[model samples]
Target: MLSTMRSGVRRHSALLLFILGAVLLTPLSQAQQLQTKFGCNMTRDEDGEKVIYGDTGEFKLDGERIEALRWESALYRPTHGFECSIDTSDDPQAEVEQDGDKSNWRITLKDPVAARHQRGYDFYNHGMNCSIRLQRDGDKLHVIPSCPALCGSRGNFTELSVDLKTGECSYK
Candidate 1:
């Protein structure tokens, strides 16, 4: 009887440790995999009469047609740690083309880590000393800038929203 009781206790303790380890690591691992799934472009419609946003830059939505670009922006997945490259056929002359190689890149998220709008939103090392908020609207996601002027206009705080299905962003 004594031996059986000791073994049972040992098993229970091991199981508890395993559960705790998983619970603690789950969030960290999931956080690293979160990324923005959609990007939008700014466009000018009807020759400065109106504008429609696209993935790259400003253009006439009606008078001029611009191709829409889409890409999945995932967190820096440590598992692969694969490098990234840029294709600028859309705008080869754009300044963004300068960073054709992924040798040097940086991304930041706000502090106090507000809840993510989607299952894949992650809190990474952002070099800022203010709170961050993410807003979502349909298939668009907007990053609420932490600039003093922006916050001041928005009651001194970052606001966030999310599209349940598309993980799009929009500012409120």
Candidate 2:
């Protein structure tokens, strides 16, 4: 009878430990699911010109640290078609920082892109100082690119705002 009681106690203790472990881990699993994923493609008419823009990426978190991030953006217009396109998939220098509910991404190109000089007379290597900044708030992502090398004198990659849920975007 004593051996039976001891075996019952051991089984109960094991069950209790399993329940406690699951309860403690529930919040962590929920937090991990809060990671953000965003993708969008949009085009609109602005002053009789067709403007196209899009972006796709995901930001994953491990505990309080960003474990992985990949992002890409593109913009096109009739006036300056293919203004800017950036892919940070293989860029080891890409970095993201989070503050409160907002996140900021800074990306620099590893190779120079060819572009026409500001004079429009000669070709020059652009993207040497190319830098892109992306800011995310709620379901919106804002793209601010300072890549003169990617866009020559004939075109520019103006600031853009994108809606992650609806895939609607507009120049800002």
Candidate 3:
């Protein structure tokens, strides 16, 4: 009877330790997935004109739900230049929806004219329909933007590829 009781106690202690370890490690694992940052900068000379463009952003999550995000893009050309930016730090119109490893961000501008003017693209009419999609695959983050009104003639935000490991970005 004594040996049997000792074995039972040992088993219970082992189970308790396992449970405590899992409880302690769970949050650390979740915290690792709670934040992500990506950006890229590239410049090239085409037709004797230097073109500079890139995207940079950071997003924070709370148990798979995006809590905040700030993304910006810029393009410079000889004839035209534009810059676009979105922030959810304090804007109620900014919404982010998560589906698996993909997220869709949409924002309704309260002052479309001011937004356009701030980005230095006042020529393009502000339609107040700004949308962006993001996908994460391993160490790569793909950014796809459909906000034509935010980006003028010389700016393109589609097919932006970011290397999360290296903080580099390029347009494919």
Candidate 4:
């Protein structure tokens, strides 16, 4: 009779432990919620290529994550990329004077992106690696991209800045 009680108690304890473990390990909606910080995501489909300016991707109401274009002919690279800066500034000369080392503005993209440049000449022939960063200043959003050796020259890294409020992106 005592052995029977001991066996039942052991079975109940095991069942309680299993229940406690299951409760602790459950996701409980944390896994299903959308990302709200820093704003980064990849495109789910190849639908943005249908248009010229590109389509919208994962973005927040504050525009932390704006629309990114991914359009590359499968024959070219079998991947998509951003072509230059989206909204070029009406005049880039003024911003050029303020350009400097933006090594700290590098951002790791969540999506595989491809970009093209129509410079006076494609000195490098191949696209250069770029580091894009975003900064909020008062009522403006600044998009900065740093490109090293764009023209294969020394001390001539191209740095660009885009004012989100005015939709003006210039070589800053």
Estimate, for each residue in 7-117, the C-alpha lDDT of model 2 and write its tens digit: 999999999999999998776454333245666677888789887776665555443344565545567777555434433333424556666567667656555332223
Worst 10 residues of 2 by lDDT: 112-121
Q: In candidate 2, list every pair of residues with a backbone clash.
A: none
Per-residue C-alpha lDDT of model 3 across residues 1-172, encoded as one tens digit per residue: 9999999999999999999999986755453343667777778897899998767777665543456777778887877776777666324254455555454444445565555566667665545455565655667666777665566543445458777788777786
Per-residue lDDT tens digits of candidate 4, residues 1-172? 9999999999999999999988864542222122112211222323544322222212122122222322111111134333333222111111111122211122333321222233333444443553444444433334444533122322222233334445443433
Candidate 2 ranges beyond 4 A from true positions: 1-82, 88-92, 111-122, 125-127, 152-155
Report the poorest 10 consecutive residues by lDDT, candidate 1: 94-103
Give residue 86's error in model 4 in angstroms. 7.3
Tens digits of per-residue lDDT for model 1 on 1-172?
9999999999999999999999986754433222333444333344345433222211111111212222211212223321111122212111111112111111222322331212122433332233222332333334443422112112233223345366454434
lDDT of 1: 0.31
RMSD in angstroms, all models? Answer: 18.2, 7.9, 6.9, 16.1
Please identify model 3 stretches exceeding 4 Å from their true place: 1-34, 89-123, 152-158
Taken over the whole model, the C-alpha lDDT of each candidate is 0.31, 0.59, 0.64, 0.33
Rank ordering of all candidates by TM-score, starting from the highest: 3, 2, 1, 4
Deviation of model 2 at 171, angstroms = 0.9
Per-model TM-score, in order, reads: 0.30, 0.48, 0.57, 0.26
lDDT of 3 at 7: 100
